[model samples]
Target: MDILQILILAIVQGAAELLPVSSSAHVIVAEKLMGLDPTAPAMTLLLVMLHTGTMFAVIAYFWRNWVETYFKSPHERRTNLIGIVTATVATGIVGLTLQYLIKHIVANGDPHFEIEQLFGNSKLMAAALAAGGVLIILSSRIKERSGVELSLKSSTLIGAVQGLCLPFRGFSRSGATISTGLVLGVSRRRAEEFSFALAVVLTPAVVAKELYRLVKHQGIAPGASFPSLIHMAAPGLLGMVFSFIAGLAALRWLSSWLESGKWYLFGGYCLVASLIVLWVN
Candidate 1:
């Protein structure tokens, strides 16, 4: 891809990543429009790099708040740590289990089947978008309780919902997790914070997996030339920088809407977006 295309993709990914919208869905659609193969090794690697950029954006935006809120006291730190760890463990288990089940079901007797093959299914994306939209809307209607703390049970529930988002492109991870938290009576701001924290923790593993897939597909064995690896990663590295800037702006926008009780507007947008995707595809 050229720099111009990369820039456009970066902006789309960065903005949508922080919004309660599905960045993957938007990026995949952009790829399709650009006549690029969304499942190609290069494209997948670029997508992960974009995710990394937004991951950093999350850290940059939330670090101070995290320190003030979760790190101010020993008891607060311990509580937050336990919640994050438990949620992460739950996410791993559910995500892996679902991936295995889906692969087996789709593969039947073929061992070569990969879940990436389904990433371009527009119909599936539409369905997932609708589901996420419904969840967000329902959760938005619930009353926000004050002084609500993150509990193990609520965190696990949020993580489980996040796992469901893993294989479905249009199922927004933030939307699902934050909504799950709200449904469990967590406040909006806290829910948003914890959801993004989980994202920062999850992104590195995703990036590594994509990198491995790219290298394996390219027949780059262990001890491959550093120059060749760098050459392959160069375009994505440029995209990452652009994405980081866009991500910060998007996060600001998202935060404003969330704090102003406009969270349900995103749900409405998602529903409309689902129809648009269906129509365009």
Candidate 2:
């Protein structure tokens, strides 16, 4: 990719990764529009790196709360830790189950495949986006009616939503999962925190999966022969740094705005994005 493409991808990764929007959807659209090969191993590596960058941003932004809640417990620290672990486990089960089911079941009979096949279908993506959007809107509406507060059950529900998001590229995992928490009575701040925490936990697995694919395909380590990997990494790192700085700003802004319970606005965005994707593709 060119420097301009790198910058654009970085910006999209940085912003959309944190926002309720599906960064993957936007990136895929951009790839197709730019005539870039979505199946290229090097490009996939760059995407993983971009995800890692955002993961770092989440950690940097939430370090304080993480320490206070996970480390500074005067009592019940063990319980809190267990709750976090249970939620993580639940998320993993759902995510991996769907992944395997799709790889084995959906693609079972196919003799040929393309990397773009990872996206499944645009129509499916559109449906997922719309579904997630409605859930978010309803969650926000519920918060307005009865006030929002998150608990263990709500977190589990969010984890369940994350699992469903694993296979569907455009579902917006953060949006659907966060909205699940909100609708189930999770506070906006906690919802956001849990969302990022889940991201951090699951990111390693996602990167590993992609790496395994690279190894299987090329019969060698990735980033070895692919000069594009190096090129992609540079801008990915730059974009990640920018995203971290920008995320801190977004977090501050989101805290107050979320309290106003305007989550439904994202539904409109998803609806519009769906139409745009359909129109283009």
Candidate 3:
């Protein structure tokens, strides 16, 4: 890809990554228009770095809040840790099951089937975006109760919702998870925090999975190919830096938008965006 293409993907990813907007929808559209293969090893590696960049942005933004809340005391640490663990377990169970079903049942036992191959389907992405939009709109209608807090059950439910977004490219993970938390009566602030925390925990595993897929596709032994793979990642490192800078700016916009009582507008935007994706396709 050219420098312009890399910059476009990086900025789109950084801006959309933490927003209720669907990043995959935007990225896939851009890739298709650019004549880039979404499933290519190079693109997959770029995706890993893009996600890593946003993950760092999330940590940077939330560090103080986390230290004060989740790490303040023994009781807080224990409780928060359990919440994170249970939610992640729930996410794993649901995500793995979906992967198996998609590969085995949906693919009719096709040995070479990979869900990532389906990610660039514009119609499928449009449907996923529409689904996310409706969920966000519905959840936004529910008012957050003042005393409601995160609970184990709610976390599991939220994580399960996140799992539903795993296979589909255009479904917004942040949108769905935070909406689920709101639907469960958690305050919006806590829901956003927990959603981001879950994202931080989940991103590394995603990066690892993408890396493995890249290695597998390349027919390279992981140990021997390490240096070569690192060399190939050099261009993506630039994307990571660009994305990190954009993410910092986008994070502030997201916080302000969330507080502006127009969040449901994002749902409306998603609905319109799905149509635009169709047109672009």
lDDT of 2 by residue, 1-281 (tens): 77677667766776777777788888888888888887786677767777777777778888898777567764546665565677777877887787666766778846564324768478877777777777777777774334554556766767777888877877887788778777776667777777887888888888888878867888346546577555546755665666566556655555556777667787778878887777777
Q: Which candidate number would show the highest TM-score if scored against the true structure?
A: 1
lDDT of 1: 0.88
Model 2: lDDT of residue 67 = 79
Give me the overall lDDT of model 2: 0.73
- What TM-score number comes out for model 1? 0.95
Please name the candidate that would achieve the greatest lDDT relative to the true structure.
1
Better of 1 and 3 by TM-score: 1
In model 3, residue pairs whose N, Cα or C atoms come closer than 3 Å (at least 3 residues apart or on different chains), thus clashing, are none
Q: How close is candidate 2 to the true structure, as a TM-score?
A: 0.86
Could you tell me how far off, in angstroms, the CA of residue 264 lies in candidate 3 after the best superposition? 0.6
Q: Per-prediction count of colliding residue pairs?
A: 0, 4, 0
TM-scores of all candidate predictions against the true structure = 0.95, 0.86, 0.94
Q: lDDT for every model?
A: 0.88, 0.73, 0.87
